[model samples]
Target: MVGSENEARITAAEFRGGAGTAAWRVTATGPQAVFRAVSLTQAASLVGPAVEAAERLGILADIDVRPEGVIVCVPDRDFGGISAAAIAFSASVSTAAASLGLEPDPARIQSVGIYVAQHSATDARPFFAAALGYEDLGDGDAVDPLRRGPQLAFNPITGDVPRRGRTHFDVSVPADQAEARVAAALAAGGRLADDSHAPAWWSLASPDNHGVDIAAWSDDVGD
Candidate 1:
């Protein structure tokens, strides 16, 4: 069980350092755990325990149970990021899963978002939010209220040479897995666009020149 020390907001690194969080990974959305199961019914069985765990912490758990597994996320919507309460909830869920003979596969934890390059984010934010039925995060980003769709981030166009692609993907994964994922993408015909931000993020382009950033910074301290 979490105590008063676990009530404050913490960085991804701090969250990961705590006990009972080994099964969870800090994603762009928050701390998430992916638990594999043999059947949909088995996956569904975790929902009640997970939800109850979150409720005990006075937070809500976003759980998606599919045919093969269950994805659980504890996001602090009020704090606009991961809070200690969220972490506590995550740990509780993991504990419950363990008791039920389930364990999280951290490598399967990731979040996908859309990156939109714009000259003036203020001018473009409203349009994208309205078009996608997303909520503007007031931080040059927007997200689906139901968390069913990828987040949308508007980045400023820098320098004289404009970016080749106006829109791209931002795949946030565990820091340790960033290099391997990049290599796999390259092996699958993707070309490196930029790696100056390696370890934090890497830009790659598809065969057709579309961009995708494999980002691991989201789980870092300063992200």
Candidate 2:
């Protein structure tokens, strides 16, 4: 539910990751920022409970369920769509843990994924924009028809990345709230790595040091 057909400018695609991994990222102002599913089956498992819990939290403002994953909507600019989605997934995981009669932190990282591309963001943007019917925002940005909401920020890379590149989470988590989110991620088995020295952007490792980034809001966007 990114938005009503009229209110949204959204588009998404499964990008190349590692050898056997792939993920989907979208452009919109909602919780459906990025979804990492190793496969179609896994996507269903991860997204179902997330969607359910998000709805229950009344935080689920929008959604667009896809076979690969889903795009959920949130409320504001300051809200962390990626983090909210993670929490929703955690809630779903917690519910599953309860159903199994086991005591476990649903917030724990059950799986990790890194969205990448076979080509650089420079090349991927035009390709994906055309493939998904989106408009290229340049500088590694692309959006759906409406040109708003969840968005994909392609990180250009040199050398070899796992499976070239795959999709993962990219959102503007505030600098103040970032440490808390990082702490929570660590508590849940995620490792921290600073990909950027800039005060706002950060890189996180999924215990395995995958290349997913949680960025800070910057004024340089689209410049």
Model 1 accuracy (lDDT, Cα): 0.80
Q: In model 1, how large is the Cα lDDT of residue 4? A: 34
Candidate 1 lDDT, 1-223, residue by residue in tens: 3323455667788888877888888877788889988889889989898878777887667899997899998754543456667767777788888877776788888899998887642346788899999998756788899989998888877552443437899999888777889999999999999999887899999999999999984555644
Q: Candidate 2: how many backbone clashes?
A: 23
List lDDT for all candidates, in order. 0.80, 0.44
Residue-level lDDT for 6 in candidate 1: 50
TM-scores, all candidates, are 0.88, 0.40
Segments in model 1 whose C-alpha atoms lie over 4 Å from true places: 1-7, 76-80, 158-165, 218-223
Model 2: per-residue Cα lDDT at residue 82? 33
Worst 10 residues of 2 by lDDT: 13-22
Among these predictions, the greatest lDDT belongs to 1
Using TM-score, give the best candidate's number. 1
